[model samples]
Target: MTDPHLDLAARAGVADERALLSAFADNYRAIFRAKVAGLSEADARRSPVRTGTSIGGLLKHLRWMEQAWFQRVLADEPNLPDRPAGEFFPTNEDTVESLLAEYDAQCEISRRIAAAHELSDTGVHHNLGEVTLRWIYVHVIEETARHAGQADIIREQLDGVTGPEI
Candidate 1:
């Protein structure tokens, strides 16, 4: 689904902190969603990349990231369950449906967190000290988009699917 938030941010310009932050959050989700487009559950799990990127792993990372920033850092929620050993690596076992469901749920949580906080809301990063909600949003957008670019390459190599084209 297209995110109107990102569109709104685009119109508002990145120089505006609130609009930039919102757009960043929206863009992160859009990038993740687009990476899995037209792929079956099994296909998304396939490790098409020689490096480490996988659609499933990417989704998992997105989940980890959102929870880390919003729920854990911002809201001070209890620690999430630790990831299993070697979970970051690419694997064939992940199903597209399961991954997609997880992604959607994480995105929903992110939306709620964003809505509940003002743009100036602050949180302590585990390593970076205090930061504004706007910073988290921008960071996530850039980080996720970077991975999405990788996903685009991997998907193309796997099935000749070019991003923004098909």
Candidate 2:
């Protein structure tokens, strides 16, 4: 039941483009966190879809999403770390708290990257040729919000929770 660190109101005073983009992405990320709050690790691993979109898996995927976009796409890091097997699924070692902590930390790293560069700063995307930090922000917002919606549905299936609640 930890209150999400980045308050939605943090965007209120941020006039810079980078901070604004980070605020939007972080807001959605927090909403995703709120949806699965208080669930046990086992409960978090419950999947309601044939695609195996469990809350834990969604969190793991999101953490990877942030890292992949920022480290790989934005920074253009050459040697990427090996992603573990079932990177999207919840392994025995993966906990709700652990995934959430990684999400929070990854969000922080994203914010720092945005702060350091302009919206026009371009980097090499793995699939796409190149994209700006602006595009990355918008893309993260879309992707994070999409997964947050899924988390909402899965949470409702588990305990009648319906909204992001943040």
Candidate 3:
């Protein structure tokens, strides 16, 4: 099957604003996912850098980001559980496979949520206050792309593998 993420780039020239933003967001998400694939759980949890950011942790954090923005902020789903304090690091209970599955699931949910809303639709954030769906799309794209770059570095440090291919 053709990779949908790869296909996005080909169609970007003609994509509307929402589709363009979604394309960028999905591409970065795919890159982040690719960075974690084929790694052992042990390797994924290993922090090569001094900051202690492992591939597993990044995956988990990205999953939380998806839920936070799409479900909590946008959809305003009630009584969502709180995230762990500070930066998220994976627990022993979090396996690489499980993290990947969770991240993918959350991404799918995010996509559906975005699709249901208009770009002009507004959401009230606790601190940001009254942000548009277009703003959220831009925010997610930047955040995911930044984290994906970090993941690329970590992956390269782990095994010299690079690029966004999966």
Best by TM-score: 3
**Of candidates 3 and 2, the better by lDDT:** 3
Better of 1 and 2 by lDDT: 2
What TM-score would every model get versus the actual structure?
Answer: 0.81, 0.87, 0.93
Candidate 1 stretches greater than 4 Å from native: 1-9, 14-16, 89-93
Note the residue pairs that clash in candidate 2: none
Give the clash count for each candidate: 1, 0, 0
Ranking by TM-score: 3, 2, 1
| lDDT per residue as tens, model 3, 1-166 | 3346855645787888888998888888877777776889888888899999988888889899988898888999899888766436988788988889889999999999999999999888899998888999999988888888888888889989886643
Per-residue error (Å), model 1, residue 110:
1.2
RMSD (Cα, Å) of model 1 = 3.0
Best by lDDT: 3
Q: Model 1, 95-122: lDDT tens per residue? A: 7776677778977898798789987889
lDDT of each: 0.71, 0.81, 0.85
**Model 3 residue 156 distance off true place after TM-score fit, in angstroms:** 0.7
Residues 74-99, model 2: lDDT tens digits: 98777877566687798888888888
Residue 57, model 3: Cα distance from true site in angstroms? 0.7
Prediction 2 TM-score vs. true: 0.87
In candidate 3, which residue pairs clash?
Answer: none
